[model samples]
Target: MRFCILGLVEVQDERSGLRVLPTGAKQRALLAALVVKAGHEISARRLIDELWGGHPPANAANALQIHVARLRRLLSGPAERDADQPERRPWIETTGHGYALRLSPAETDAARFQHLTDQGRRALLHDPGQAGELLGQALSLWRGPALQGSVLGDICADEATRLDEHRLAALEMRYDAYLRTGRHGEITGELVDLTLQHPTRERFYDLLMVALYRCGRQAEALAVYERARTRMRHELGVEPGPALRELMRRILHHDPALARTPGPRPADPSQPRATPAPADDAALSLGDEMARLHRRIERLQREQDQLLRCFRELTASAAQRDMSVNWEGS
Candidate 1:
């Protein structure tokens, strides 16, 4: 059974699919705690404290064991339950510290989402189409809120919060890729929705302004900056950041650079990529110096060769003159 914590803390089976988990809130919370702390030992004390919130039962250890047992049983999918095969290893491992949920990165959607988000971020500038696709796949893993409907302890809540942040970052990155790939018209409406959903996230407003300008809605683009400025001033008592302000200035001045160009072209996978241009000024200067020195060395060699030829010609001419003088003497 695969543990999906990107959305709800649900289980998915390959053969039967979407197995129902125990209805008990604590049971789900225990499973969530283990999954969040997957592969790490969690002491019984910590688990009890988190589960009971300073009100652990007299038989806390036994209650915890019962929950672990139920979770172990839940891990066994219908295929495992129906199989006449030999007994498989348990999903929960008992450790000297306490217990650990036996899970790997591949077993959880959260890990996959993170992996894809990272890959997309790395590809954002060069291969934006592929980046958009990867980021989309990552975002798609989120069915709703992370660990949705599960009673969360501190560990689970922290993980959920982190994943939510990651999701928002991924959304911004994907939208950036979309804009870079000339999908501006398509994303403007969505950007508007995002601005409403996450009013404090300034990046969305920045992107929406750009998208609107590209779509030839210059007035709306400027109006977006006004809205952002008004919101920040009214709520946060600060002006928009330099990025938004700069964008506003450029849009107001009708900067020609804001006009849409074709998005980054998809690179061919079969072909080896050309070396990227040097990003550092020092590196570029060094490369140019090396090139200049090589050309100077070649020029100096040519001059030396020409001088040698001249010297040889002078010697030959002097020798011929001497021979003539000797012949005249003879």
Candidate 2:
């Protein structure tokens, strides 16, 4: 039997291919909370607060008992269906102060998703193709939002947010693996979808820019950087990070390394890949770019001085004209 909270809170019976779940909102919430801390007891106080929105009824204990009983019956009833399957029968356990669900990571999609994502991320430098496959498997497990359908309590909401973040990170890792394996062109459309879905996520823009440039759309790649810069500044009220800015600079220079396909390298696990040795030519190019920037900044300062002078002249003339009109009237 598998208890799934990756999407809806439900139970899937392996033998009968039957799907059963809690129907009421509170019941579903209870099941979700328990499943989040599966195999461990969650305090009755916390469960009560979550189940009742921090304002449980006068007889909250009895009400909780009713919900628990219903869930137990829902999970374990129809004795005939589970007579041969003892494991499928009786999943929820009552504790001295709280409740626990007798479940393991093998039977939980959420656990499996996190586990696979971790494995995929670790395999990135050593085996990108295999990493992509593992990450793809992890991503496929998400049916929708974590703990879908139930009114998310604090515990559930936090878990859901954490899971969603892992999902996004896994996606970035998987696509990064694809790029490392030189399959950028094939994933442009999918990356576009991800960019649209997560416009504020600069990693997607970084990936898109590389993919576009590799597809011989250098101009489009630069355009993607511009869009990211504008959106980041306007919406996020900040500039793109240094890594993204460097990527843009590399694209502008048509960095040969960006175009070259990267080969699989052994991962260290203890240390990050070392930065490439700096090139003198790159330093010279950077000097030129910096010189141009300084020139542009100086020009802008001069323009600001000119605008200030113009504003002062206009103010003085207006004042003089007003004074002359007053004298004529007098």
Candidate 3:
């Protein structure tokens, strides 16, 4: 059987693909809590608390037992066991203190998604192309917000937050891989949307700037940085981080290192691949010298603006003095 919690809570029989979801809200909540933390035994009191929040019914324990029994029967199927048929093991086992729901890693999409994202991240530094593929697969599993169907108790809410965090991390990693592989032109639009959605995240701004700069949209890249700075200052009362500032400096000077490199050729799956040479920090640190230069440029520009204003004032004052002198002579 496979359980889905990415969107609605659903349990599908592996053989028939039939959905066997509990009808009642409390039953569904109980199931959701167990499924999210599947493989661990949840105490009876904890399950009761999740189902009823602060106030539980006088017969809450009895009600929980009834729900557990119904779920067990549904999972076991309706076929009558005969003398010839082997004894069926229970899916929901009764523990000493509470109940535990046993499910394989493949049975739940959330677990599978986590597994794939972890694997993808591990391979990210060495095999970014493969990492992108795996992370993409992990993201595709989510149809909407996690556990959209059931009311979220504390446990369910925590699980949802954890899954969402993983989802965002995977997306960021995939985009980083895409940028590294010279797909800047393609990712710029999506990065624009991501920046709008998560303006506080400096990494998204950095990636967007890089993509725009690489695509010959240098002015737009600078504009993005300005927007980020404004948003950050207005919202968080802080400036953009160092990496993003460094990237801005690079774009200002038209750094050739910002130009995209030809991505590595796709390796054959059957062949044992040689290790790639350690990559240079050119893409990352090429702007170290430029950072100081950019700071100086900004200081000079400010000074120039002050000088120009002083010059204009002095010229106006001299004209007035000449007019006064001519009138006095007359």
Candidate 4:
């Protein structure tokens, strides 16, 4: 039997490869309570608290036992449907005080995800390619939010939150791996979704800005920084983090290091060598455009100065002519 908590609380029969989860609320709750702490034995009192909180039934212990029995029967695989031969061994074994669900690390998706992420993190510094592979595999296991369809108690809720955080960290790590390999264009869309999904996360915002800047969208990258700064200020009453701020500064100055990767060589040998390739062409066009705009602005400024001078000279000449006319009349 395999337990699944990545998406929902479920038990899948390995032999038949079919989900055989209990549908009742309390039964699922009991299973979840045990599955959350798979290896260790949870006391009956704690199980009661987790399942029913402070409002357990008069025969709460019996109810708990009944739920446990249902879970065990369901966990006994496909043979539980057969009346001829009942499976002797139960997944949930009764201890002296309460019970313990026997589950290997690979048996639960959550556990497996955690294990893969841990391995990925360890491999990150030494082998980013392997790290990305492992982290990608780890992230692929998540179908939705932790315990997607199940009602979470305090313990489960906390565990779910922890799991979600781990998932985010793994995602960021995987993205970082991609960034290291100069695959920023590929991850920009995904990073945009992540930033929208987690608006407060500066790391996502930073990655988005970097990706946009690397893709030659400097203005858009700066806009993203401004949005993040504004949101942080208006919502949290704080400035952006150091990393984001530094990236903004780099973008503002058009740091060459950000685009250190050389652009593709131009094709078409017959074409004039003057025209740059796509990436270099963008940078060259921006520089030439800025220079042309600067020249136009300077010329406009000179014309305006000349017009002001002409206006002043005409006004002076008219004043003198008025004075001469006034003197002749006097």
The whole-model lDDT of each prediction reads 0.79, 0.81, 0.78, 0.77
Highest TM-score among the candidates is held by which one? 2
lDDT of 3 at 304: 100
Q: What is the clash count for each candidate, in the order shown?
A: 0, 0, 0, 0
Best by lDDT: 2
Per-residue lDDT of 229-282 in model 2, one digit per residue for the tens? 778878889878999889977977769898865766655689764342233564
For model 3, what is the C-alpha lDDT against the true structure?
0.78
Cα shift from native, residue 201, model 3 (Å): 1.9
Candidate 3 lands at a TM-score of 0.73
Error of model 3, residue 140, in angstroms: 1.1
RMSD of 4: 13.8
State the lDDT at 2 in candidate 1: 68
Question: Against the correct fold, how does model 1 do in TM-score?
Answer: 0.75
Give the alpha carbon lDDT tens digit for every residue of 30-61 in model 4. Answer: 77777888888998888888888889899999
RMSD of each: 20.8, 7.6, 10.8, 13.8
Q: Once superposed on the true structure, which residue ranges of model 3 sit more than 4 Å away at CA?
A: 78-88, 262-330
**Residue-wise C-alpha lDDT for candidate 1, range 1-330, written one tens digit per residue:** 567887767777756655656667788888888888888999988898768877889999999999888877877654366465334356788999689977776778888898999999999987888999999999988888988776547878788889899999999999999888778878988999999898878999999988887776666777787788778878899878999888877866557777744345655699874331212454335434544664696699799999999999999999999999999999
